[model samples]
Target: MTLALPPLVDHHCHGVLRRSPDADTFTSHLTESDAPAAPGTSFFDTQLGFAVRRWCPPLLGLDPHCPPERYLERRRELGADEATRRLLRASGTGTYLVDTGLPGDLTGPAELAELGGGEAHAIVRLESLAERTADASHGPEAFVEVLDHAVAAATRTAAGFKSIAAYRYGLGLDPEPPTAAEVHAAAARWLDGRTPGERLTDPVLLRHLLWSAVRTGLPLQLHTGFGDPDLRLDRCDPLLLTDFVRAVAPYGCPLVLLHGYPYHRHAAYLANVFTHVYADVGLALSHTGARAEAVLAEALELTPFGKLLYSSDAFGLPELYVVGARVFEEALTRLLDAWTASGAWSGPDGERVAHLLAAGNARRLYGLGPDPS
Candidate 1:
C-alpha cells in the first residue's frame, strides 16, 4: 500500500556518540576473537562492555568495562552519517522526532539539522540525571547541576528542548533506582520556577512539570511501557499511570506516551479515555514481535483516531527508522485487511485508516499546521 502521510516520528532515543573507529575495531576484534571460542567466554566478554550490566549480569565473559561516556562517544560517531538517512528512506520516514539523550553542546543538534536537510523536529534531551550518575553516587545537588547545564544548553540551541527527567527503573549509572520523591525534588530544583510539563520522563514528576509546561503551552511526553530489559516489567505497566494521568488532566498539557509496550492495550485505553493522553505506537510495533499487527489493532480498538501517533524511537541503528517503518506498514496492512474482512471497515475505510495511521493523528497531536501537501 502506498503511504501518503507525514514522515514517521521516533519519540525517544539516545543520541549518544556511535562507536569510534578504534571502538569499532575493538568490537570487530572481539567478535572475531570469540567467533570460534566457547559460547560462555564470548558472552561473558561482551557483557563487560554493556551499560545494562550495572543492573543485570553480563552475558558470556564480557565485562561491563566501558563507561557511559564511552558509549555516548560512540553514539556521536554513528549518529552523523548518510546511513541513518538511508535507513529513514527505506523505512518510509519523512519526519523524525530525534531525541538526543542528554543535553550537551549544540553539536548534535547542529549536525542533525544539517543531515535532515534543514528540517527536523528535534526533541533535545535536557537533564538526564540517571546517565550522569550512572557510575557514581550523587547528591540531589549534583542532579541540580546537570539540570542547570541542560537548561542553559537548551536555551542556546536552535533545536527544541524537552526535559527528560529520572532514568527510573535500572537505567542509570547508580546501582540503585531513583525514588519518586527524589525525582520530584530534583525536578523542582532544575525547573527553578519555569513551567514543568513540557518534558518527557517518569510520571512521578508529571504533575508539577505538566503544570509548569502547560502554562507555557508546551506538550509533555511520558515514557511508558518497556524499553530496557533491565527494568522490571511491572514498573513499565501503563496501568500504573492512572493517578499520574488524573493529576495532569486539568493542566491541559498534551501527554505523549513513548514506547507504550507490553501494556499497549492499556496505553490505548488511556488515550481513548483521556483527552490529554496520546499513545505513540512506535517502538513496540517495530521491535517486539511479528504480532505487532494484532497488537496495533487492539490498541486502535480502544484508542480514538485523534489520540494516536507514530514514532520509531530509533537509536543504536540508523536503519531502525527504515526497519520500524516497514514493520509499521506491514502491521497496518494486516490490520486494515482483517478489519475489511470482518466488516468493521470497508475498502474506503481502510484507506482512511492508512491516512490516519500514517499522518493525520500526528498532525493533530503536534498541532503541525495544515498538512504539508
Candidate 2:
C-alpha cells in the first residue's frame, strides 16, 4: 500500500540554477567531492544520478530512466525557467526553509516560494552573518558589538539559525562558550591578517556565533555527519558535540543535526537522549537514492518520531528536489507499511508517523502551523 503522505516540509534545501546547465556542468554538482571525477568514472554512476533520471525526466516531458544526455536535451528544450517551475511543483513541497548562506547566484526564499507554489522561510547562517559583520567592523571590539546585534536581528524573524563550524574548525572544539576577551582577540587576529571577504574560519568567532544563536532561543541547525572535502569526517561526529549540547540546554533552543549519513545512528542516539535535540536525514536520503530505505530505517531506529524532520538538502540542480522527495516517499512508505503488516504498528499509527515525517513534526519544531491549503 502507498503512504499517501501530506505536502512535504522541506526543512532544509538550496535554490536551483538561474540558467539551464549543460550535461557535464549538471553532473559535476551531484557529489560532495571537490576534486575532478576519478579518471573515467562519473558521479552520475551513483544513486543520485540514477534517482534523478528515474524521477525527474517525466517533469521535463520524457520517460523515466531516460539517458542522461536525453534528459538534459529535454530539460534544455523546456528552457530553464519552465523546467525549474515544473520540477519544484512536482516535488510536492509545501514550504521551504532555504539557506542563503552559500555564495551563489541563486534564488532567495521569496523567489523559491514563487517558483514552487509554496510557502518559504529563511534560515540565517550564523557564520555568514559573522563574516559580513566583520567586513564592516574595524577592530575586535567593534566586531563583537556588530555581530551580537546581527545575530539577534537575523533570528528575530527567521525560522532559526544554521552553522557550518563542522566545515571551519570542526566539531571537536572546546564546548564551553568563550570569554569576551577570547572573542575579541581571536577576531582581531583573524581580521588584521586576512584580506577582505574571507570565509569565517576562526574557532573563537565560531563559538561566539553558536552561543549567541543559542541565546536567541531559535532552533539551531548544525551540519554534521558528512559534507564537502573541507570537513574532517572523524571530527564531524555528533558525539563530539555532547558538551556543547549540555551548554546550550539552558537556553531552551532546539538543536537540529543535518546530513548525518555514516553517523546518522549516532545522531539518533542524541535525539533519543536529549529533549531539545533532533536529527535530520536530509542529504543522506538524496545521496543514497535507491538505497535510501536501509538508511532511513537506521535513522528511525533510535530517533523519536516527533524529532525526525524531513529536508531535501538539494542544491544547484532542480532534479534533486524530485529525487529527494521520491526517495523519501518510497522509503518511508515501505518502512512503515512493513511494520504495520507485522502488527508492530497499527495502520493509523503508520499514517500519523508518516505525516509527522512529512510536515507535522516540522510544523511543531519550527512552529509552522497548519497547511495554508
Candidate 3:
C-alpha cells in the first residue's frame, strides 16, 4: 500500500562540501551537535548514521548498510566531484533552493542545479547580508542605506529570504518592525563596537531584517526549533512567534518555519490558525532517520494540507541528500498507506496530499515548476 510521490522539491538545503571529508568529518554529518559526540558513544550508532549506511553506500557502489570505513573508502575511490554528482542526481529531487549564506567553499546555486539536473534558486540569508553590509558602513545612517540597497537587490533575484534569528537572538524578540530612530540607535551601537566578522545577534537588527523581507512580498523562511549547539531549544519554540505571526498575517507574506522538531506540533498549530504561516519538519526528518515516520505523522496533525511543504534542510554532506529523500519517501508511504487502508482517508485524496507535500506546495510558494529545459 505504498503511496508513490512525484519528484521532490528540496525547498531548503545547502551546497555539499567541495573537498572530501575525513572519518571525523564524515561522522560529524550524523548529528546536529557542533561538538563531537560523547567520548565513548559515537554519532555513527545513531539513527541518521545507520540510515546513511543503508541508503548511501549503494550509490557509491557498495551494498546497503555498509561499514563506515568501506563507505568512506568507496567515496574516496570515486572522488568528491563524481560522488556528489551521483548522490544528488540519484536523489530524484526536481528542484533545489540552496542557501549560500553559510561559510564554505561549497558549490553555488548554478552549480548545484547543474549537478542535480534540475532548476536551482537561491535563498538569501538576512543576517549574513546585514553583517557584511555593516562591515562596510561608517555610521548607522550609512549602514541603513547600504543594507537597504543590498537587501532590495538580493531579494529581486532570490526565490525567497531566510533568517536564523532563533540561533542569534531567539524567537522571543519584539515582533514589531523597528522605527527609523530605533534602527539608527541600534546600528550605531553595533557599529561602534563591531569587530571583523563579528556575528550579528542584536534583536533589533534581526527583526529589522525580517520586516525588510516582509516588505519584499517574497516567502520568508525562518530557522526554528532543533539545530546546532548555538540554539536554545526552549527559546526556539514556534509559539513565541505568536506576536510576530499576528503582525505579519495581514501583509500576505508567507512565513515558513523550518526544521520544527520537538515543537513540530506547535509549529503545525500556528500553520493551522494563521493564513500566512507554513511549517516543515525537514532537518528534523533527516536527522531523525528511522523515527521520521512518527515525526512526520505529528507534523501532519494540525497543519492544513495547503500550508505544509517539504524540505531536506540537509547540509555539508552530499549523502544527506540521498538519506533525506529515502527517509521522506518511506515515512510518507507508511503513514498515508495506513490511513488509506483503514478508510480514514481515500486513496485518491491521500495520493493528492502526498503530491502536495512532495513538491506542489513548494512550487506555489517559490513560483517554480514545469522545467523550462
Candidate 4:
C-alpha cells in the first residue's frame, strides 16, 4: 500500500509573489541561475519545468502534462489571488516557517498562513536586520547595540533566525565569537563602504550576527550547498561548517542546514554526529523533480529520521509549492513502501519515520502545537 503522509510542516520557505509574474519572470523562478535562458531554449525544458507541466495542470482544471503556454495562459486567466489560493490549498501544508530575508513584493507570514489554510511563523534574516538598522546609527559601537536590540526584539516572536553567510562570505568563517573591538572595527569598515541597500557581507559582522542569534537559544538556519550566482558552490559545502558547528554545540542552539544538494550527504553526516544539527533537502527536491528520490535517499542515508525536517524553500511562485509537495510525497512514499516490503523496516516503523520527517520533528524543534486545521 502507498503510504500517505500527514499534512506537512514546511520548516523553511519563503512567501509567494504579490503579483502574477509574466511568462519570462515565471520561467526565471524555475532555475537558480540569475541569467536568462540561452537563445531559442525555453526554461520549460528542465526537470522542474517538466514536473510543473506534468503535475500542476490538474489543479487548474486541465489535464496533466499540458503545454507550458496553455498552463501560463490558464494561470494569467485565474489571476494571482485565485492561482495562489488554489495551489497552496492543494499542497496540504499545515504550517509555514517563512524566511523574510529576501526582498521582494511577496506576502508575509500571516497572509501566507491565511492563504494556505494553515499557520505561519517568521524566520528573521540576520543580515537584513543589520542592514536595516545600519543607516540609522552613526557609530560602530551604536550599530552593534542597535543590531543586538533588533535581534532580541525579533526573537520574541520569530520561530528562528537565518544567515546567508555562505552566500555572502562562504562557510569558512572563524567560529569563535569576535571580540567587541573587532566587531566595532568591522562595523566601521562596513559603514564606510556602504551603498544604500547594500547587503552585509563583512566576515566579522557575519560572525557577530551568528553568535548573537546563537545566544538567543533559538534555532538558526544556515543556507548551504547550491544557490545562485551570489555564492561559490564549492565554498557553500556544509562540511566547511564543521568547525562552526562544533563551536556552537555548547549553546544547545539547533543548526538547520538548508537545501544541501551535492553536499546533502555531508549535511546528513553532520546531523548524524552533532546532536544539535538538522538537515533538509528543500530546494534540491523541487529542482531535481523526478530525481528527488535519489536526493532524498542520500539525505536519509546517514541522518536520523528525527533529525530530518521538511521544507519547500518555495519562493516566487505557488506552483512550486504544489510541485515540491507532490514530488516529496511521491518520493518518500515510494522509499518507505519499498523498505517495508523488503522487510528492512516494519510497516509501523515506516509510518512513524514518514510522520517524523513530514511534521513531527519540526513541531518538536519549534515548540509548535498541533496544526489548528
Per-candidate Cα RMSD to the true structure, in Å, reads: 10.6, 1.0, 1.2, 0.9
Pairs that clash in candidate 3: none
Q: TM-score of each candidate?
A: 0.65, 0.98, 0.98, 0.98
Task: For residues 121-205, write the lDDT of model 1, one tens digit per residue.
Answer: 6564433423343223255555445544544454343233344332343122222224656675755554454333333344434
Best by lDDT: 4
Candidate 3 local lDDT, 1-373, one digit each (tens):
6666677899999988888999898888788888988988888899899989899888888999887889899989999989999999898887999987999778888988887877789999999999889878888899899999988999768999999999998999899999988888888888887896898988888888999999898999998999999989989999999999999988889999998889999999999999899999988888888899999999998999888998888788888888889999899999988999899999999889988998989989888855343
> Can you tell me which runs of candidate 2 are displaced by over 4 Å?
none
Error of 2 at 330 (Å): 0.2
Better structure of 3 and 4 per TM-score:
4
Error of 1 at 98 (Å): 1.6
After the best TM-score superposition of candidate 4, give how far the Cα of residue 88 lies from its true spot, in angstroms. 0.3
- Collision pairs in model 2: none
Candidate 2 structure quality by residue, lDDT tens digits, 1-373:
5777788999999887889998777988888988777898887889998888889988888899888888888888899889999999999998999998988778888988899999999999998888888788888888899889888888667999999999998998788889988988898888887777899888888998998989989899999988999989988999899989988888899999998879999999999999999999989998998889999999999999999999999898878888999999999988988999999999999998999999998989998998766
How many clashes in candidate 4?
A: 0
Whole-model alpha-carbon lDDT for candidate 3: 0.89
lDDT of each: 0.53, 0.90, 0.89, 0.92
Tell me the spans in candidate 3 whose CA falls farther than 4 Å from its real position.
371-373
